[model samples]
Target chain A: MTTEMTHTTASEPVTDRPIMTPAVDVYENQDELLIVADLPGVTSDSLSIDLEDDRLTIYGRRKALCSEDTPVLMGGGRAFDFRRVFTVPEAVDAEKITASLEAGVLQLHLPRHERTKPRRISIRTAG
Target chain B: MWMTWNDFDRHFAAIDTLRRELERSVGGTRQSRRLGRWPEATLVDEGERFVFAVDVPGLTQDDLTIDVHNSTLTVAARRVVNPPEGYATHRSERTGFEWKKSFTLPAKIDGERTAANLEEGVLTISLSKLPEAQPRRISIA
Candidate 1:
């Protein structure tokens, strides 16, 4: 089983605000590893994912678009602020890490280090 | 018999009042809709196309609705709160807001033929570029 460590931090501190809880899914394939995060109401421009010295940080804020002038017939109370961090493993290639956003989902791909990638060695039987 | 001016004024005032209320209710005003905030999402590009996956646990495919228009993709869903009936809740972390998400497609995407599939509560959308958007080789004269 692959072991992982997670840490949470906020780039901009907001006092008395509830912490955002983010759910993540990490997938690995022969070529690279993928990290998918579920962050609703977050746009690509508003999201920030950083990898600093083996620690990967994901942060974002969700703001309400509704105005006071408009009447709210119904509403639900939910937490919007979210922040999560993960300690990347040494097998991940930091330089090649890339991320994208679509449908409120953020995906990060961390390519495996060239040296860590599997290499097939040819075996020759003694004749 | 001619109705008194006072009575006619009252009748007309009642109609005007009803019209004002109808206008206020049906006018082009955006009703504030609050969306339940879930976790953030990450998209990964897999050589052929982009794989968009979201971490949504305890949700089934029937709960999600995905719509694509032009270059915009919208994903909306409702997460029903499953609680024991007549059970008093002390504290709850789950927020029962309807989730609504939208994204603008990049130039390298074929908005017409996009496809989406959900697995294990994670939605994967395959976005491929049109033939024209893809790079082609032209011979130099």
Candidate 2:
């Protein structure tokens, strides 16, 4: 069985303000890695993805839509910022990283480097 | 062997079950926040309305149901996982679940005025308070 290692090392970097770490699911295949994070209430205009020092960072803010006339009586509202960081493997093709957000979920695609792809070996019969 | 997403989900579910057992033993009768399959929810009394927000990632309006009966609000939904055919899943952490919850309104509300909307997987419900239940300022004689 081929063992696939998910996130080897994940950390929540300190933001200027405290932030919640969005729940994430990671998958990998022969060609690329997929990272999906659930960031409800976050809009595309407020989402940000960055890569620095081999660490992939995701940040987003979900704006609250309350008005002065509306007073919050109960707790547990989901209006806050999201932040998470993951260390990328050396085999990843950082230059080819791509991301998309839909319905409040963010998907990141990281392609494998050409050299890291597996290749089949051919045997030569004795001449 | 190629690992499919279904296999990965089973593995995680096993670990989650074990973890829950440990927590139950150590925490001493603490209740989990999960309501059915949905995450924790918040209920707010917005003076004129009661607002409900439930975290339901990867869900759409078609998957949810909202109803009011006898001053109680009920929300129900199911999250289904369907991976594309032919793609071998290396890992998976998201799984399908059923979410069902009901809450008793603190005060009478106008059921006819209730409204709900789903955005980014968060289901929000607004229950307008009955006119009599609203606070009224008394004028000094």
Candidate 3:
């Protein structure tokens, strides 16, 4: 599995807004894998998630509350978009995958395919 | 001894499992260069009122405490991490901490009329300037 760099050089950097990698935590269990990401100021309309070809990508855009054109009394926080990518080794149940956004936090649940889950075999006693 | 197709596949699977474990343990954590400036804040002057905004994602209104005194506004919050049940953490990059920050206003503020709102993980506080501080046109005869 590999992590993708948010600030890629392939594309020219947007002068007013740059790209940022949102912080995330990955959790796994026998039933499913849980991915939690923090995307501040991201709205439902601006957030996007995609999974294809064993790659999972999370992208979001946040509108700046204070624009650069306006007069500034103090400046600290800069405006930026968020993006992150991850690779999945095992086949996931795409139909069962669920995602939700609350308080700007994104939570994704990827259930393992039934075929990929471990199963116990029963043995019969010899007569 | 000769290798069979099944054996070859099993060997590769074991090696793949080992590689996956190593990657999980690597567990990257970025932002060393931008340390000490978390939940960045900005203050902007909009005519008669000033707007102060902060980026505190994944935070609820109850998780924060705000105090305003004259031209100084203080925002404090203590974040707690609570992992869900029946889950094993493979990588944890999100951190929790007690953070407090203050911003200064350019003009005297009418504290009584100041208002703060939290939406989509951003906290925006509007401080209206006092009547004395508002710009007034002066005429000379």
Reference-based lDDT, each prediction = 0.56, 0.68, 0.72
Q: Comparing to the true complex, what docking class would candidate 2 get?
A: acceptable
User: Between prediction 1 and prediction 2, which has the larger lDDT?
Assistant: 2
Ranking by DockQ: 2, 3, 1
TM-score of chain A of each: 0.77, 0.78, 0.78
Candidate 1 off by > 4 Å: A1-13, A68-79, B1-141
In terms of TM-score, how similar is model 1 to the real structure? 0.44
* CA error at residue B2 for candidate 2, angstroms: 68
A1-127 in candidate 1: lDDT tens per residue?
Answer: 0112122343446564555556565666666777766676566666788899988888876654233343221221223566777888899989899998765566688898999987899999999
Tens-digit lDDT string for candidate 3 (A20-71): 7777889988788999988878998999888887878888988867666776
Give candidate 1's chain B TM-score: 0.57
Winner on DockQ between 1 and 2 is 2
Q: On residues B31-90, what C-alpha lDDT tens digit does candidate 3 reach at each position?
A: 522221255566677778888877666888889998889876778977776788889999
Per residue, candidate 2 scores C-alpha lDDT tens digits across B106-127 of 5677889999988877788888
Q: Can you give the DockQ of every candidate in the order shown?
A: 0.03, 0.29, 0.27
The order by descending lDDT is 3, 2, 1
The candidate scoring highest on DockQ is 2
In model 3, which regions exceed 4 Å deviation?
A: A1-16, A76-78, A120-127, B1-37, B137-141
Deviation (Å) of A104 in candidate 3:
0.8
iRMSD per model? Answer: 15.6, 8.3, 11.6
| TM-score of every candidate | 0.44, 0.73, 0.77
